[model samples]
Target: MTDTQEHTWGERYADSLMNTFGQPKLVLTRGAGAHVWDTDGKEYVDLLGGIAVNALGHAHPALVEAVTAQLGTLGHISNFFASEPQVRLAEKLLALLDAGPGKVFFTNSGAEANEAAFKLTRRTGRTHVVAAQGGFHGRTMGALALTSKEAYRAPFEPLPGDVTFVPYGDAEALAAAVTDRTAAILLEPMQGEAGVVTPPKGYLAAARTIADEHGALLWLDEIQTGLGRTGRWFAHHSAGVTPDIVTVAKGLAGGIPIGACIGVGESGTLLEPGNHGTTFGGNPVACAAALAVIGTIETDGLLEHVTALGQKLRDGLAADPRVTEVRGEGLLIGLDLAAEVSAAVTAGALAHGFIINNPTPHRIRLAPPLVLTQDDAEAFLTAWPAILDEAFEGQS
Candidate 1:
């Protein structure tokens, strides 16, 4: 591998692909477990886990085998027909939720899942939705409308309207914002894009009660926090609240591209026939891949592993004086630096053969694979101080 190998590929990517995500970080070639190799033959420990998508890490045998077997048998079928894997995956998700009698609408990504949930809210004859400030649902029109970022929403103005944004973790503000006309109250159990910000204790419960009082549906967007990412089947489970709707993706299929919008009890029936539809939503391969991920997590006891590893990582990260705060559960961790140097820290980590993310100027977020090894974690911790020193070298 040479500079030409990576540089030439970067040029080709710029020429052939849309510039939505800016320049490619690295021309990655292959991955195994929590490590990936670049086109330049450099190996990096993937601490970001494909932005929380690769729950089982790279090239997991279970996911690959499930997808290959399913595709070999029945790769795809139209929504007009059903598949066993699709039905079984839905049933498994509902059983894990334990919220009693729910129906699932599968999609190709989290944005589509949120889009389906948004439409479901409209079926209640109400247009207004109360969403939390600093909350991120997705980039699609409906989900973007619910999102509170002006930069993201300004460019896509005229997004579906009637969505109200209230301060997160503020139960009073949330209660005041909702009305009988409010169709739904959408929230993230833990705000991931907002630097893995967690709401106050009982905030979700408060929102649930508020939704009940207003006769509005409680919709929890677990796209980044669900499916054992937070060491629980769902992040809201910790709050002990049963939401009317839940949207999940990212790691649902361990990077197989699948999302689900689950509606509990009577809310499941709201999306009447033809209210919503998807072409590749319940493709057999994707469903089978998701089933395999769920199975692997259970069999491997990854939930406990994530919980313990998260605490270890958090404690080690917070040991540094430059780290102001650390927040998150399981593998979805976020830390704030003393200065606005998260970008420097990210680059520094990469230079040290590790991959991390800077969601904000001062915030570093880590959603590593559930299968991240203790040795890999210890390696990062041992290198943490040097990475920070390099990042803060020139800072005054």
Candidate 2:
């Protein structure tokens, strides 16, 4: 297809699709490995990795085979019956979390998974939840209440109230806000949507101590940083603290839609029968895809690859003077630009055959696939200075 045809499709997209996400960036037709081609056949390295959802990269044979075989055998079974893949995936997640005797509630997306967790917290016989500023749980009502972004929560006022927002990474503020009345304390091990912001050392451990003191459930939103994205089974692993509740999605199924709310120890039994339910939450096909993703990560050792490549990319990206700071772990990287040129930088990267994200005016984030090649990383670093130059020039 030609550029003109691609432009025509973009117009059609504007006409047909909802305006929630604004204009489409590119009309992507297909992807393979860590690369994608737009409708016009323009090739680009996918540094964002479908916003960190494509764990094994595009068209991974393991993911494809699993989804295909499962669909052929049995596709959607309502929550009335049990499926092998669903139970197996649940067990696998528990093992990865290292949480003994937990329960799992699967959902179709991150927001839905968070919704399930939110509902589970309600069963604690308390109504108050304490979350952190700059933390993003999801867009749903219950999850939105926990999210601290005023822009996201403003239009939808009168949200489910009794939620408190505290400064992230500040154990003191968290301790002050959380008390015996609090039902749960929610946090993201690494704040992903906030430009991959990392918390202070020992913050998660402090949260665990505080939650325990108040008899509040500790919940970590690991949707963006879990399942080997942070070079471990979970980001909080490095902190060596176990959360009472953990929400995971966005790579759980490697690209297939799946999310899970896991409750550890006694918290696992909080949501009893008839407390909550979903129609298509634990679909067999999605569970099978998740199993394949977990199996591949364990067998192929992508975690080590992500760790080494991430360090290489971070070191290289920071070598440029325009980068003020670099943060995050593994493939989930965020860098601060010297100026508010992240939008221009992202545009310039696309023009130079790279895909990136600008979550804020001055923050450029990269959550590339775990399977990204070293060659691709080197190429991006090689082009980094030029991309910065073009972006700054555009700003001027």
Candidate 3:
């Protein structure tokens, strides 16, 4: 395949697919490890890791084998019946969370998981939810109501009301907004969509205290930060606070479509038999993929690897004077550019065979796979200056 072939595929894609994502940047054909090849056969290191969903990278042998083996035996089954993988995966998630005696509601995506949690909060007889301003939960109507982005929420009006938005990382503001009537205080331990913004120290603990005082559920949305993306089973683990409800997806199944809305302690029983349901949420194949992802992360020591490599990448990326600030933990990294050139930088990086993301005008985010090699990180670092130079030239 050549550039001409890629262009042809792009045209075909435009004709066949909806333009929800604006335009196809590349027609990706195949992937292995942390690398992918486009229709034109151009190889690139996937530093964005499918927006933090590919925890084990692409086509990992363990993930493939698990899915294949599960599909061979039992694949899809209605929620009326349970399978071994589904039950086992739920237990495994509870064990990993270290939250005793919890219940899990499986979903197909993060938005669905958040929606499950949102409904669970409603069971407490309160409708008001206090969420952080810059935090992003999901795109569904229920999750969208909790998301504070005016642009995303504006177009979809009359969203489930009684949701209040407060400034993120501000414990004072969070404490003020949450009241006795608030059913839940929703937050992300570290904001992923707001360009990996981590809250101020003790903010989560403060939220817990406030929730306790107000009798509100403390719900942490770890869709992007959970399942070892942030060097821990859950990023909120670093804060040493136990949330009543936790929503996880993104990397939980290592590219397989699976999400879990876990409620701990009393909150676990909020959603009774009649409260919620899903047809394909806990399918055998997805559950098997999730178990395999967990097994691989433990066996390969990927958590420690992510922590070390992340620090190295951050130090190297921050060494460039063009980067004003760098934030995030483990493999989820975000850096601020000296200028609003993130769009040009991302385009330049793609041209240089490195994939990155621009979450905001001045922010560049990197959520590479846990399996990313030191060589790949070093290669990106080596190309950083030149990519910047090209992007700056484009701006000029």
* CA lDDT of each prediction against the hidden true structure: 0.95, 0.94, 0.94
Assess every candidate by TM-score: 0.99, 0.99, 0.99
Candidate with maximal lDDT: 1
Residue-pair clashes per candidate, as listed? 0, 0, 0
Runs in model 3 deviating more than 4 A are none
Residue range 1-396, candidate 3, lDDT tens digits: 767777788888889999989787887889999999987678999999999999999999999999999999999988999999999999999999987889999999999999999999999999999999898999899999999999999999899858999999888988889889999999999999999998888999999999999999999999999999989999999999999999999998989999999999999999998899999999899999999999999999999999999999999999999999999999999999988999999999999999999999999999999999999999999999999988777777
Q: Candidate 1 at residue 287, lDDT?
A: 95
All candidates: CA RMSD in angstroms?
0.7, 0.8, 0.9
Q: Report the error of model 3 at residue 29, Å.
A: 0.5
Cα distance off (Å), candidate 2, residue 272: 1.4
Predicted candidate 2 versus true structure: per-residue lDDT over 101-187, tens digit per residue? 899999999999999999999998899999999999999998898898999999998898589999999999999999899999999
Model 3: lDDT equals: 0.94
